[model samples]
Target: MIVSKVSKYNTLNDFLKSKTFMKIALSMTGCKNNRYELDQILRWAIKNKVPVVEESEADFAIINTCTVTSIADRKSRQLVRRTRNNNSGLKTIVFGCAARAQKKVFEEITEVDVLLGSMQEVITYLESNISDMKKCDDASLITSGEAFTRSRALVQIQDGCDNYCSYCIIASARGKSKNRPQKEIINEINKHVANGFNEVVLTGINIGAYGASLTTRPDENKFAELLEAIFEQTGIKKVRAGSLGPEFFNEKWYKVMQNPRFSRHLHLSIQSGSDSVLKRMRRNYTAGQVTDVIKKLRGISPDIAITADIIVGFPGETEAEFKETVQFVKKNRLAKTHIFPYSERQNTLAAKMEQVPVKLRRERVKKLQEVADICRSEFIKSQLGKKAEVLWEHSRLSGRAEGVTENYIRVRVMGARTAGSITSEVLTTENIDTLL
Candidate 1:
C-alpha cells in the first residue's frame, strides 16, 4: 500500500513490540544516514528477540531503497523481485528514498505488501498490523547502542535536505530540513559513550545545514554549537562527521576542530570543482571557497585528512571544466575521493539540460579515478611511521585484526587483538595493506 501520510503512531517503539515472533530479512542500498536507520530496525529486532533470517527463510522482508541514481533504482527493484522469488510467501515492505521518489514504481511491483515514504509511515504501519504491541522498556534503545555486530555507533543528529541542487533529487525525496534537539543528540552520544563505543558518527542528508530549521537557536553556526556541546557533555573518544558542505567551515567550526576529540578527517561534498559547473548545478559554494576551507583545515593540523565527493561529467561540462576538477582534486592532495559519473534523475533540473554522452561520462570517471587513486596512495604513504588511533572492527585472518584509523585510513595489524578495542599503532608499510 502507498503511504499517503503517517498514521497515529507517536514513537518508533510502538511498532517494534509484537506478541508473536516473526523472521525478517533486511536489505538496503544508500548512504550512511539510511544505513543508520536500518541499524535501528535491526537493533529493535534484536532487543525484542525477533529472528533476522536469510531471505529464503524469512516470512517478511524489509527493503530500504535508494534512488540516488538510475542504477540504484534498478537495484532496489531487483532486490524486491529477488526476495519474492526466493520465497513466494514472503511479504515485502519497501521504504526509503526510492519508494518515496517513485512510489508508483514500487506499487507496480506485485510482491510489495507495504510501500512507505518515510520512517514515520513505517512505524505507523507496524503499529497497526502487529498484534498485542507494547512500548519498549528501555527508551535508550531509540538512540544509544548499535547492533551487537558493529564496533562504532552512528547517531543521526538531523534528517532531510532543503538545498535543491540541480543535479540532486534528495531534496524532493527527503523533503525539508529537520533538526533533532541538542539535548536528544547529547543524550544519544552519552549513551554510546557509556556502551563502550569509542566512536560516534554524526550523520544526516545535509549535515552542514543542521540548525537552519531550528527555532530555539539564534546562532548561525548551530552545528558548531552542537559539536561544542558533544565535546563538553559526552565522554566519547572520537566524533566523526558525515559528508558536509564547504560553507560549514567557519571561525566557530575551526575553533571546535582544535578539540582533540574531533576526528581529523573531513569529507567535503564538492560535487564539481569547476566554478561554471558548480554555478550550473546551483551549489552554494565556489571552488575558491572550498580551497580556502581546506587550506585552513590543513593549517590547523598539518597531517589532517581531507576527502571529498566529486561528480564527474555533469550536463554540459566541457573538457576544460572536467580538467579543472582534476586539477582541483590533485592540488588538494585529498586523502580519498568518491567519484561518480553523473546520472540523470527524473524531475531534476539537470536531466533537462544538455546531457553528457554515456561513453564520455565513463571515460571521465576512469580518468578521474586514476587521479583519486594516486592521491589516496600518497596520503596513505604520508601516514607511514606516524602514530594513529585505530578502532578495531573485525578480523578476517587468524591472529590478525583489521580496523580504521582516526583519519579514516584502513589498516591491518598482526597478532591477536580484540574487535572492539582501540589501540595506537605506528603505521608501517608492512602493516598497511591495500596501499595501491
Candidate 2:
C-alpha cells in the first residue's frame, strides 16, 4: 500500500490534488499575531475543503509556537510533543517565533516534519504544496475578511521589530520590521465590518514602528495617519490597538484619542518603571516620560483604562528599582498590568548580566501582582455610574450575559443578551466586576 501511494503521486502537491481526503488539526501557543496567523491558515484550509479535526484523528497538525519567555518555549515544545503523541502517523509542522529563533530546539524533535520560520514561509509553503490554492487578496501574505472568532477580528498592520530590547528574543525571531500598506489595512477592516464584526484590533509585533519601513508617501504611513485613515475609510465601530511602546505616544497619537470609535484602553509596553532599569532594558523612554504620557492620556479621556506590561525581576534589579515600579503602578492607578518575571534569553544582553535568583524573581512577581490587583479593583470601582458600550461575547441560560466594555472592563448583566450585540449600559457595582 505504501509503495502504491508513493507511485501514485510525484510530490506532496500531487497528493493534495488527488482524490484522497485529508484532515488537519491546528494548535498554537503565542500572542495575537500567532493567533492571527493560525486563523489565516484555518481560512485557507476551509477554502480548500480540508476538514479540521481533533489531533488524535488528524492526518496532519500545524503548531504555531512561541518563544517570548522560557515558559512559553517550554509550552511550545510540550504542545508539539503532545500533538505528535496523539496520532503516531500524524505529520507535525511547526512555525512561528520559536521555530525561527530556536530552530534546533524544534529540529531535535523527531516528530516535526516541517518547520517554517516566518509567516511568509508558511504561506509560500502552503501555496506551493496545496493545489489550486486561492491567493490572498491583500498585499500582506495572510488572508483577510475573516473574523478571528465570532466577535472581534484582529487586523495585523505590521510584523517583526527592529527594537532589540535587552531581554527580548522576538526581534531576532521575527526579523526586521515590515509594514503593510495603509490601503490594505483599511480594506481589511472594511471586510471585517461587512462580516458583522463591530470591533477590530490593530495588532503587530511592534505597532509603534508601523511606518518605519515605508518610504513612499511617508506622511500617509505614520501610525497616526493609519489610524485616521481607518476611522474615515472603514465602517468599523470600535478600533483597539495592540501593545504599544512608550515611543508610540506623541502629540499626534494624543489627538487621535479624541475619536469616539477608538478604544479607551491602552496597553503600554513599559517593561520597568525605574529609569535605571529602563536604561538596562535599552528602552528609549524614561520613567518620567511614561508618567507624562499616562497623565496626558487621562486628560484626554478621564475614564480611559491604562494598562501596561511590566517585567519584575530583570538582572541586577535592586529592591529600590522594584519599589519604583510598584510606586509607578500605584501613582498611575493602572487599570491592569500584565506582569512577568524576567527570563533570560540566550544571545540577549540581559542574559549575560548578573542574574536574579529564580526564587527572588518569583517573589517579586507575587508582590507586584498584589499591587496590580488593588489598582484593577480601584479602576473598576471608579467606573461606577459611568456609561459604557459593552460588546456581549457570552450568554448564559439563567438570564445572564457577560461582555467587555470599550475600555476593556469585563461586565456582567442580568438579562438575556445575544452574543455579538453591542449595547450601552450604565456601569454600576452590580454590573461591573473587579476580578479581572
RMSD list, candidates in order: 4.8, 5.3
Q: Which 10-residue span in candidate 2 carries the lowest summed lDDT?
A: 1-10
**Candidate 1 displacement at residue 108 in angstroms:** 0.9
Instruction: Please identify model 1 stretches exceeding 4 Å from their true place.
Output: 1-20, 133-145, 214-219
> Looking at model 1, which ten-residue stretch has the lowest summed lDDT?
4-13
TM per candidate: 0.90, 0.89
Candidate 1 residues 259-363, lDDT tens each? 988988888999988999999998877999999999999988988888888999899999999999999999988888889999999898999999999999999
Tens-place lDDT per residue, model 2, 1-436, is 0111233234444445652455678889988888888877777766656666678877668889999999999999999988888788677778888988888777777767777776567656665564554333333323233534766888898998877889999999987788989989988788778878889888889887788763222233478888899998998999999898876667888898789999899989999999999999988889999999999999999999999999988999999999999999999999999999999899999999999998999999999999999999888888889899998887778789988998998889887877667999999888886534
Runs off by more than 4 Å, candidate 2: 1-19, 132-145, 214-221, 397-399, 434-436
Provide the lDDT at 124 for model 1: 58
* Model 2, position 331: C-alpha lDDT score: 93
**For each candidate, what is the lDDT?**
0.81, 0.82
